[model samples]
Target: MVVKRRFRQVFTSLKEHSRVSYAKIATIGGFCDLDLIVVKATSPDDLPLPDRYVHELLKIFSVSASSFRAFSLSFTRRFGKTHCWRVALKCLVLLHRLLRSLPDDSPFRSEILWTRSNGLLSLYPCHFLDDSSSASEDYTMFIRSYARLLDEVLDCLSIESKEAEEDEVLESLPDKMKEVGRMLEVLPQLQSIIDRVMDCRPTGASTRSFLVQSATKHIIRDSFICYTTFRKEIVMILDNLFQIPYRSSIAAFGIYKKAALQANQLSEFYDWCKFAGLCGSYEYPFIDRIPQIQVYALENFLNGMWQLTESSSSPASLLTSTMESPLSSTEDDSDKQLVIWEKVEENAFPRKLVKDEEEEPLLQWDVVDNGNWEDLLEASIGPCKASRNNLFYHSNGYGNNMGEYGQGEEANGWQMQLYNPYASNPFYQPQT
Candidate 1:
């Protein structure tokens, strides 16, 4: 009796503490004999939640105080919480894509530029977090910093090699040398921030605004400028050295990657990475190895080009010459052949949220409409000519139900106007 009484008291304690409970609302398709019951369940699958909900749950858990907690966005059959591990995956996928842009022999040839850009687009639906309370505030800061890091890292990568001295000088701060482990930890949070910033309601509009905002933000923009300049410098150096700029040169020149490996920026690195995990709620390991793979592809592309330069004959035209190719008249060796384009088609990663079969892809929305504005207007028109108002009103069977009387003096005396047999619309012509 005592235990039962206690249970009842706790169940009635919503007055003292915020309570969570299940409710069975009205049935879907209720008019039919068979109804679909809409019940709010304890599971995350309640209400077919969008992916953004998961980001909030995972990010809050990153703060020290909230680390043990977990929240989830649900689907009826499957579900997951947004966690730190997602940050790791986001970095890994992006880095992998960036590196793949370099070719095998070129050392900087990337094969997945298109693929990676697509992945970036796929990273949306992660912004609905509201972790302002002290319980989850640290995680929010971590995310903000992680976004700033990505903005800077990309900047360093873009810089030309001629300003290497200046770039190095500017990068002297301890935070500039963070390690790969640290970077991995924060990727998800960065992913969350970016993912959220890029997409809002009405879909495509937010991405443009977000990009513009990022470009204008001083810290983020400066970072891009630094890397872009650094990349330009390396390209110039390589162009002078071997009459070629292999992928390896540009990939190896990153400030963050170099500093991290050197152990000088490990503290800064760890801080950012940890913060990223806190924001994204996931850790990604794959980011660390992507550069190596990209380097290999670039190396192969450059070697192939160099080998051609070494043995090619001035006697034959460059276009017709198959002599420098791995496939040869004299040899049947497979490794000698350069598989430039079609070699990796089957291995590409699948993206999230492909559109429906009949739907046209997202493009600009300023196009001509066939007709019908009155049907689209849900609100009342302040004042328009009676004829215009009559268009929609007369089309409806219960036109008078709209708070305006259609009978008596409101109906102008123009009803006796004779119909023209030669009118444009044949339906309006008088009967023969």
Candidate 2:
């Protein structure tokens, strides 16, 4: 009888403070679900339950104060107290239904169940997560800095407009024009900062490993999602700014292209990491397939750009040779060999020689003596001797026959005399 009275009092208090109907409270299947909703509600002023109602509810539900307090502190610290309790209750109920859909022995099932029962805010604690708050802060800083730069650029444009009005007849502009020019000069510096921010993504192997080591897979995945969304918002802002006619110069296009490229690479890496996280394996076919997929994407982008431009020159052509080689050489070895052969065919014989059937034979072999074959062979096989006009023999003591022959004026003259095949005498000397 006493227990029934205490439950009645707790229900009445909950009805008064939370505005929940008595019929609904009575129809709740278990004390645990009621307790979860009440705890989540009590953390914020969104549903302001009186202190006495909270105490009675906890006592009736048999929930420990310490557990509720810990969960409230942790959750409020991370997400703040601005959430709507009714919406939070709905989300929790939906999440609980989803969890119940999983198999009984699933790790996620056990982990989420344990977190709920222990009054923990998340399946994985905030302490186990990476410092994503710092990254968010940095992102905010980048946005502010870029916003200021844009403002300055706008100011410069305004000043230039004013100077143009005042300098209609002047050959050169005055100090205001000079000031605007100086302000415009700082635009590149601003663009460089934007480039740095885009390139600052945490896609390195070590950073990913660190995140995996320190946090749950879901935490790391959520962090990546947050980061990617943040960057996407910034990219949208940049795209909007670039749409302004004055800012649509070639240099601005180049900066936007670079930022888009880096963002794409980061997003690809994040997607791969997320897939690896879900599959619980970062090894093997997963890692190996990333480059292939990237190359495929690059090929599509290049092809699309080529179709749009229809020009021989492409923006991608400006990439360093090393980057272009891998992208261009994605074909199989047989295909590559075929390409090489085609090139060889095109370049090897650019001009064809005309046939001359009426032309005489270049040499008459019948006049050659067949008996002198041995002598011809001996002469052809022997080392050549250097002549007097050869600079190499004059510089080096060794003749063209190498060390086998000495370098002397008399020996050279004698060799030259012996070389006169048309002379009647065996030895002949010509005037120096």
User: For each candidate, what is the lDDT?
Assistant: 0.27, 0.32
What does the lDDT read for residue 92 in candidate 2? 31
Off by over 4 Å in 1: 1-215, 236-334, 337-432
Error of 2 at 147 (Å): 23
The TM-score between candidate 2 and the true structure equals: 0.19
lDDT of 2 at 293: 30
Candidate 1 C-alpha error for residue 79, in Å: 18
Error of 1 at 87 (Å): 19
Give the range of the ten consecutive residues with the poorest summed lDDT in model 1: 70-79
Q: Write the per-residue lDDT of candidate 2 for residues 1-432, one digit (tens) a residue.
A: 667655654553453345334323644755443435444433322332334434443454244434434433433332222122222222232233333333333343333334445554332221221122223333323223322322232333344445566555554745543333333333444434334333334333423333222222322333343344434443433333212222222233344344445555555655655564532444212211223333223332222111111123333432211122212233342211100001112113111112331122211222122333223223322344544222121122234343233344432331211111112212222223
